[model samples]
Target: MPLRLPPLPALRFFEAAGRHQSFKLAAAELNVTPSAISHGIVGLEQALGVELFVREPRGISLTASGADYLSYVSEAFSLIAIGTQRLPNHRADRPIALSCAPTFASRWLLPRLAGFRARWPNVNVSVDTSHRQVGFPVDGFDFAIRLSRAPVAGTAWTRLFGERFVPVCSPAYLETLRDGHGNADLRRATLIHVNAASEDWQAWLDATGIEGFDTTGGLRVDTIQLAFEAAGMGLGVALGRRPLVDPDLDRGALVEADPATIASTTAYWLVSAENGDRRPELADFKRWLVSEAEHLETHADASGQTVRAAVS
Candidate 1:
């Protein structure tokens, strides 16, 4: 007896189209044109005697059947990837590729990666700083660290830690905020704003119930790192997210302008495919990352300080 199956290429097209819900995107991922993807999917539908996608005026969507098929197809691909990595000839020292936002990569992960390297001398880690949504295996990344209010769908994820934002500035700038009566006055202080996090300053003000300060005037920078740098140079007060601002606070480069802190809805998440941990090196990396996050949380709990938010 022989197994009945559609052509492998057709299956690939169908899976990609269904996953992205866009023939254009599927074509891009497969390095083919939209017409080619459409033809391949039509061919697949004819072979299976069933339609996988529901064509719409604006775009395409997976039929209920298509969604069900995608689950199986995706799982099959994940298993193949795991099995291939487990083969005897597979390189055990293959580098672990990760995707994350630039601010996180620079302010937090990069500073701490040396510790991971010291622990696992054999495993090399590659980091790609991207704010775009990335797919696993398709993007050729072993894992991704995403900041989101909720877990990303269609992937396995672990919440690393939540974030809290506080206003930070140089010691001199902090002193400048004080009046002759030694009372804190923010009306005269410059507000340094990160363009990406434009609402942070206002959010902090609202959360702290601090009135009469105009958040409209500020020096706007594109990234949190740049904002922190500007604040360090005495440009203005930047709303600094904890863990990201821990190093600056520790080194005396930045200080909390106010003790009030506002919690962020978003948290850092470690994301990967279902079988991402099957590889020995990847499994070790996951364990180490989780352990590091736990250690940081534990240390923060015991410190009783708002500025020193995490592990030293």
Candidate 2:
């Protein structure tokens, strides 16, 4: 049997009114007047031969038929939206959607992405930098790299690498410390704080079991990357992530404060929807990611030796 579909504009009007229970609000969203919205709904109800909504004194309510149809309408709209979003990717030569933390994207992922692109020249990568947790199926992301101690529930997760924390400062700042007689003299130096995670400084202090130094005295920034930059500019000493700061350390832009360090409770992870098992793109991206991660681990191990030697 052929499906008899209502006019799309009328269906859209009906759906919006049903959702908000207000013709005026629906009109605002649809960029039409309230009368236009109401007229459209009435026309739709007439076509369907059913009263879809009850006109209440204060507002409006859905009729039984309206409630039943509303469910189908909402689902239809959702599917339409999803389809619309996927259209561009479908036509593109290489389509991959990746989401990750902003700082991690800037510091770690961006540097290594060129390699991925070189290996898979046909793959088009779209990167989204957001702190919000992205859910699969609903979020429409193909894959994500996340920093956390535990995998997000209900997702396929792979540990990319562990992270460690170290105190870092610019060469100029280190010179100041050396001139002032060393890190133990940092009591008089400026400290940079990352406001997002208050425990970072405390964790380093606890790991080193260092006492008598005030960890809280300094300029506070929202992101680790910003703090790292501030430290590079000799603004203050920043608590740094080992992997993210490796380049700076190698360039002699920053120096480690101590040989002792603590493993971050949070580690970098590669994640995809459990249902993404069947997606060829997701599979290829995952395999590529694992290999890249292994390569990074090897590089970091070698870099750590140089950092230790330079500091010693």
Candidate 3:
């Protein structure tokens, strides 16, 4: 059966009014007068045989039916926008869409992006750094770096690198403690914690069997990057991942407190649609990602050995 569709102008008018609950605001957005917006919305309501909005003297409010319909309409428009933007001819000069966790993108990928750009100067790369999982077919992302223990189902997955977790502090913070390389040493310093992973500090304590430590002291942050920053400012000792803190460790902004690091159950996974085999750009990206992961793995192994040696 053919789908009956409302006029684009009417739908646009209704969507704008539903969003802002003000015809004046809708008119401003549409670059028309309030009466024009009202006319369009009224026409839309008549065509649908329902009162979409209740007009109050001060403003407007959605009826129950209008609220429900507005949700679907808003979603439909969002999907339409995504579809139009992702269309081959409609897209900007950049052709690749890469989704990543914000922390990973900021701490690791951003630093190394110049290398990828140097190699693929013509291929445009678009990065999405939302924490939400990207739905391959629905979200239309070509590739993603997901921080997870397992690969996403229904997609081709490549393991990136296992993350190592350890206690880290700024040089000045550590100098104050003076003691090095034990669970006991950490107890004397202020401890920074990431609130998102509530169990991380407990897990570290359980693994190391450290005593007399107050896990709840100092600053509590919502993100690993923020925790690291706080620790770097001599706020406290932060439990950090090697990938996110490696550059800091190299630059002397932070130093690992213990050689005994915990291997995170979760690791970064490189994911793409199984059907991504058809696109040349997708294929190139997957190959590049695997090579990059291999490089990271090698460096991680060497770093682990160095830490072990230093601790011994």
Model 2 lowest lDDT segment of ten = 303-312
RMSD values for the candidates in order, in angstroms, are: 4.7, 8.2, 7.3
> How many residue pairs clash in model 2?
0
lDDT of 1: 0.83
lDDT of 2: 0.77
List where candidate 2 sits over 4 angstroms from the true fold: 1-94, 179-184, 301-312
All candidates' lDDT scores? 0.83, 0.77, 0.77
For candidate 3, the TM-score is 0.68
Q: Which candidate is the best by lDDT?
A: 1
Model 3: residues with Cα > 4 Å off, grouped in runs: 1-93, 179-184, 304-312
How many Å off is the CA of 154 in candidate 2?
Answer: 1.3
Report the error of model 1 at residue 282, Å. 1.8
Per-candidate TM equals 0.74, 0.68, 0.68
Clashes per candidate, residues 3 or more apart or on different chains: 0, 0, 0
